[model samples]
Target: MAKNILIVCTSWDKLGDTKEPTGCWAEEVIAPYYIWKKHGYNVTIASVKGGEVPMDEASLNPPYLTKEVEDFLLDDEAMKGLMDSVPLSDVKGDDYDAVFLPGGHGTCWDFPDNAELIALLSHFVDYNKVISAVCHGPMGLVNVKGTDGQPLVAGKKVTCFSDAEEVAVAKENVVPFMLETRLKELGALYECGPEKWAPFALRDCNLVTGQNPASSARVADLVVDALTWK
Candidate 1:
């Protein structure tokens, strides 16, 4: 049977108090979505509040947009899925084999400190299900605790959008917190690729993480491998 996978995107569109527009990174979600679909997994899109999930406009511009992202934009069926995402509160861990979070600065505002999301992540961890995140998506994992009551990311090898990458993009001060710093503070043995914006992904057991949008497809491939091997 094909496994069901949940792809959670950020619902928030405003970038902090700056009122700037931002949402899920297009490639981060599109790359993984296509990869999982190509591998015969049933993928579902969801967001914190459900309904239309915005894409970070910056990610759609030249230099950031990719063929996969452009393809996603032109695919009506895929766009429909994103536009009609289910609410995160309606998502049940038991219904899916894996859950993925794709990042945007918007995620920094909504993914972290979400009690329900944290509990859902804990449930996935307890069941040994795959939990993957890329870029700012790892913010979702920050507050999740394991069965032993420790932060789920504590002592785990992981990676996300790095501080240097944020600085390079000039969003270091705009985002709510530096993702690399927050993950490290949570006790994650966080690692990154040799250079900023490089495609890098790491998997520790059932947990998979990617460093940036460039790493999204790699992260999804790793998730598929882990699910198949398990």
Candidate 2:
């Protein structure tokens, strides 16, 4: 049977109080969505809210745009799926083989404190299922508890949008908190590649994470490998 992968995205569309538009990073979700499809896995897109999930404007143009992202935007089926993402409340973690979260600055606003998201991730951890995220996406994992009643990321090797990268993008003060620092505060053994904006992914057991938009594909590939081992 083909594995079912649940992809969670952010519904928050505005930057913190600035009213500037920000949502799911196009490449973050597009890259992984295609990778999963290439491996013949079923993908379900979901968000904090049930309706259309927004994309960060920054991710749709110039330096952030990639061939894969461009193709995804033009594909009717893919666009339809994203536009009609199922609400997180409507989906159960047990229905999927694994779960992946794609990051954007928007995630920093919604993913960290969402009870449904935390519960969904908890189910995966409790069941020993693969859970993966990239960049700010790991914000979704911040509140997830392990079987031991501790943060799922605690004592686990993990990586996410780093503080330096946040500064590089000049979002250090705009985001709610520094993701790498927050992960570290949660007892995660966090680390990232030496160079900024380079593709970097890490897997500690069933938990997989990537460092930035560029790392999404590797994170997706690692998720596939994790599922295979199970």
Using TM-score, give the best candidate's number: 2
Clashes of each: 0, 0
Stretches of candidate 1 off by over 4 Å are: none
- Give the clashing residue pairs of candidate 1, or none: none
Model 2, 102-134: lDDT tens per residue?
999899889988988988888898889999999
**Candidate number achieving the greatest lDDT relative to the actual structure:** 2
Q: What stretches of model 2 exceed 4 Å from their correct place?
A: none
TM-score of 1: 0.97
Clash count, candidate 2: 0
Error of 1 at 96 (Å): 0.2
Compared with the true structure, what per-residue lDDT tens digits does model 1 show for residues 1-230? 99999998899899897778889899999999999999899999999999999888989999898998899989999998888999999999999999999999899999999987888888899899999999999999988987788888898999999999999989988888899999899899999999888899999989999999999999999999889988
C-alpha lDDT values of all predictions? 0.92, 0.93
